[model samples]
Structures are given as structure tokens and as C-alpha cells.
Target: MDTCYLCGGLLELLGTLGRLAHYRCIDCGMEHSAGIDNDPTPTKERTDNDTDMENQGTSDSNHD
Candidate 1:
């Protein structure tokens, strides 16, 4: 049985095409592809506007 790298849950084999095997996590329901170097963890790139918004929110809360 294969385990999911992100959630460590049981992985179910959906199907295979050529040399690639697809899998789906039963616990998290996340789909994964075998024989590939794909990262499942999501990431967001922070911009200057995002930082400014966070600072504004912090200052607004302090004013009250």
C-alpha cells in the first residue's frame, strides 16, 4: 500500500497510462501522479501590497 506524502493517508490507485500511475488519497482526497516530480504542498508568493494590507490591518486593530 502506498501512502500519501502530504497527509500520510492511504493511496488508492486510480489507473495507469503508459509509465505513469495515478493515485488518489482516501483521507484527504488529493490526487497524485506517480513517476513525476510534482510538489503537492501549495505555496503563495507574497507581494508588497499584501504586506501593506497586513500592516494596515494591524494598525487598525490597535487604534480601537
Candidate 2:
């Protein structure tokens, strides 16, 4: 049985259309299409303003 590579839960077999099959992560709501490589997480681009969270220790967005 195929499981979600991301969430590690049982993958739901949507249906086979022609030569393609689809699957979805029940936990994370990530979708996988048959003919495409599955990227589980959103990729963040490095920016000049980007810094280590441990070093910065805070965000500009206020908690209040």
C-alpha cells in the first residue's frame, strides 16, 4: 500500500485516469499528481534580510 511520503499516513487513491493516478496526504493536505515530482513542503527563497531565527530571536511582526 502507498503511504504519504510527507505525513506517513495511508494515502488515499483518488482514481486512475488514462495512465495517471493521483494521491493526497490526509494530514498535511498535500496533493501528488502522477506525472509530476512530489514536493512536500513549500520552498523558501533566501533573501538579503533573511537571518537565523536563533540569532535574531524575534520577528518584526509584534506578538501584541
Candidate 3:
């Protein structure tokens, strides 16, 4: 499970700011954007987590 760098708390996807997804620590309220790593594959797509959330009809915009 991905954790917050500051508090080691479980992170939750808040929303996307531009092309990057932002996450927040549920425990400490620490917020940060998701990191994009360089993949050798030639696919340009969002993370699976983001895709899954979208498929489930949940999005950052829906939170508000």
C-alpha cells in the first residue's frame, strides 16, 4: 500500500491537478501528488488505480 512520505499514513486519491493525481494522507492531512515513473513500455495512460476509480464512477470532481 502506498503511504505518505511524511507520516506513513495510508494515502487516498484526492483528485488530479493537470496530468498528475494528487493524494492526501487520511491521518495527518498531508497532501502530495502522485509520482510518475519512467516506463519502458510504450503505453501512455493513467495509473491503474486511477482507471479503476474512473470505471467505478468515482472521480475527483465528484467529491465536491
Candidate 4:
């Protein structure tokens, strides 16, 4: 698990593509890159999980 540079807390994986890693600070909602060291192998598709998450519930703006 990566750590956030801004908050000094464990980072949560937000998204990624190719060798680039995207992370967010769970505590502060800040997005940043996770340094590329042992780049993971390529996978089939991206954004599928994101779509699932979005479709599963109403967005924050839609809530009353």
C-alpha cells in the first residue's frame, strides 16, 4: 500500500493506466501519483470497476 505525500497517511488506489499509478489520500481526498518502481503487468481493461461503482449508486450531487 502506498502512502500519501500530503497527509502522511496510507493512500487508496483510485485509478491507473500503463506504468502510471494513481492514488488518493483517503483522509483528505487529494489525488497524486504513486512512484513507479515495480510496475505491475498490463491488464485487460480499465474503468470497468469505475463504471460499476458509478452505476451502483447515485452520485453525491444527486443526494438531498
Candidate 5:
């Protein structure tokens, strides 16, 4: 999971703004944005299951 570089707090995604994805710190309320990674495979739309997996801190077993 992503964290706030400034305060080392947990970050909550604030959705995409323009071409950048935004995040906010839960403790400090700091806002930050970054570009999505340039993966060779194209990205797909996020789904509820995707969020559930992230919240559980588990990744697909298919990845090494």
C-alpha cells in the first residue's frame, strides 16, 4: 500500500485527476498525486473485488 512520504501516514486514494492519481494522508490530511506506472500490459478498469483484495493486503497468487 502507498504511504505519505511526508508524515509516513496511511494514504487513501482520491481518484484520478487529469493524468495523475491523487491520494490523501489519513492522519495529516496531506494531498499528493502521481502518474500511473507505465506497465507493458495495458491497465484494466478497477472492480470491487480489486478493492477488496487491496484492503485485505493480499495480492493475486499468480504474481511472483
Candidate 6:
């Protein structure tokens, strides 16, 4: 299962909205969304690199 970015907890799929897949952390209750193209499988393991890339993207978007 994919791990939560905030708390490293197991993430459960809440549902999908069009091409977006939504998840919620079981531990911290933090919500996350992934594009179906980016993540073909919701149960895929999340790596540290994935987290870093996501964080980088978020930071870059903040500059816009």
C-alpha cells in the first residue's frame, strides 16, 4: 500500500475523481491525491524519491 507523505502511515483510497485518485492517511488523517497517469496503481509502494519529487513540485508551484 502507498504510504502517507505526512505521517508515513498506510493510505486508504477514498475514491477517484476523473483521473485523480484520492487517499487518506490512517494515522494522521492527511489526505493526498495522485494523478492516474502518475500512479497507475493506488496500491503501489511509495518511495522516498516519490515524496521528494512531490515536495519539489509543490514548492515550485508556490513560486507561480
Whose TM-score is greatest here?
Answer: 6
Per-prediction CA RMSD (Å): 10.9, 11.3, 14.3, 12.0, 13.2, 10.1
Pairs with backbone N, CA or C atoms under 3 Å apart (clashes), candidate 3: none
lDDT string for model 3 (1-64, tens) is 4677777788777775566676767887766665454211111346799878778954457534
Query: Clash pairs of candidate 6?
Result: none
Ranking by TM-score: 6, 1, 5, 4, 3, 2
What are the lDDT figures for the candidates, one per model? 0.70, 0.58, 0.62, 0.63, 0.67, 0.74
The TM-score of candidate 1 is 0.54
Q: Which stretches of candidate 6 lie over 4 Å from their true place?
A: 39-64
Q: Is candidate 2 or candidate 6 better by lDDT?
A: 6
Q: How far in Å is the alpha carbon of 27 misplaced in model 1?
A: 0.4
- In candidate 1, how many Å is residue 50 off? 24
TM-score of each: 0.54, 0.45, 0.48, 0.50, 0.52, 0.55
Most lDDT-accurate candidate: 6
Write candidate 5's Cα lDDT for 2-64 as tens digits. Answer: 777777888787788577777777887777767776211112446899888888956466754
Model 5: per-residue Cα lDDT at residue 28: 77
Better candidate number, 3 or 4, judged by TM-score: 4
Candidate 4 clashing pairs?
A: none
Candidate 4's error at 22, in angstroms?
Answer: 0.4
Candidate 6 lDDT tens digits, 1-64: 7887666889888999898988888997777788876642334458899988887745434534
- Candidate 5 differs from the real structure by a C-alpha RMSD in angstroms, to one decimal, of 13.2
Global lDDT for candidate 1?
A: 0.70
Better of 2 and 3 by TM-score: 3
lDDT of 1 by residue, 1-64 (tens): 6778878998887887776777888998778776544433322446899888887845444534
| Candidate ordering by lDDT (highest first) | 6, 1, 5, 4, 3, 2
